[model samples]
Target: MFNMSGLDLMVIFKLAGIGLGTTLINQLLKKTDAGEWVFYTTTMGIIFGLLIVLQYVLQFFEAVQTMFTF
Candidate 1:
């Protein structure tokens, strides 16, 4: 439903990197004796995931606009 010619494997790699970074943060926090860090780590991960997903949302809106000639 959207033009994905500009999207490629690199995007997937970036997302994976985000996930890994979040995992590392979680692990590091878990080791530091700071329980609150766990919540922060999870929140950061969710934010990052949402940011990545937003790209697709923007693309979807663009596709719809193009289809409607608006």
Candidate 2:
């Protein structure tokens, strides 16, 4: 089962915020002449998501090291 912890929830909230912000920006930019805003927001979201994943990945590696080390 995928149980969520406080830190997990926080990460989810942060990612959701990023997605919502990007969506809002994309919607607003759709009116003007700049059609590339959607792509910009999408790339930004991907970058932010990757950053968050990397932080958790580092934590996971540290935990594994601590567990295996006597």
Candidate 3:
């Protein structure tokens, strides 16, 4: 059996929402011939997503450290 926390679920949802929003915006930008802005928007989305995940990764490392007591 595996245990999943609310934080994990939230992280997944947050990433998914970012991805969906980015895709939608990208499509809209393309349609409107604003291709130049698409790169910035996509980059911002990826950076934001990575920042969210980075917090969890740090927490995971701390937990592992405490578990091993080293």
Q: What's the TM-score of every candidate structure?
A: 0.79, 0.77, 0.83
**In lDDT terms, which candidate is top?**
3
What TM-score does candidate 2 reach?
0.77
Looking at model 1, which ten-residue stretch has the lowest summed lDDT?
1-10
Per-residue alpha-carbon lDDT of candidate 1 for residues 30-54, written as tens digits (9 for 90 to 100): 8888768888888888898789879
Candidate 1 local accuracy as lDDT? 0.84
Model 3: weakest 10-residue lDDT segment is 1-10
**What's the CA RMSD of model 2 in angstroms?**
3.8
Estimate, for each residue in 13-41, the C-alpha lDDT of model 2 and write its tens digit.
88889889888888888877677778988
Residue-wise C-alpha lDDT for candidate 3, range 26-65, written one tens digit per residue? 9999999999999999999999999988887788787777
The top-ranked prediction according to TM-score is: 3
- Which candidate would rank higher by TM-score, 1 or 2? 1
Per-candidate RMSD vs. true structure?
2.2, 3.8, 3.3
lDDT of each candidate versus the true structure: 0.84, 0.79, 0.86
| Candidate 1: clashing pairs of residues | none
Clashes of each: 0, 0, 0
Candidate 1 — which residues are off by over 4 angstroms?
none
Give candidate 3's whole-model lDDT: 0.86
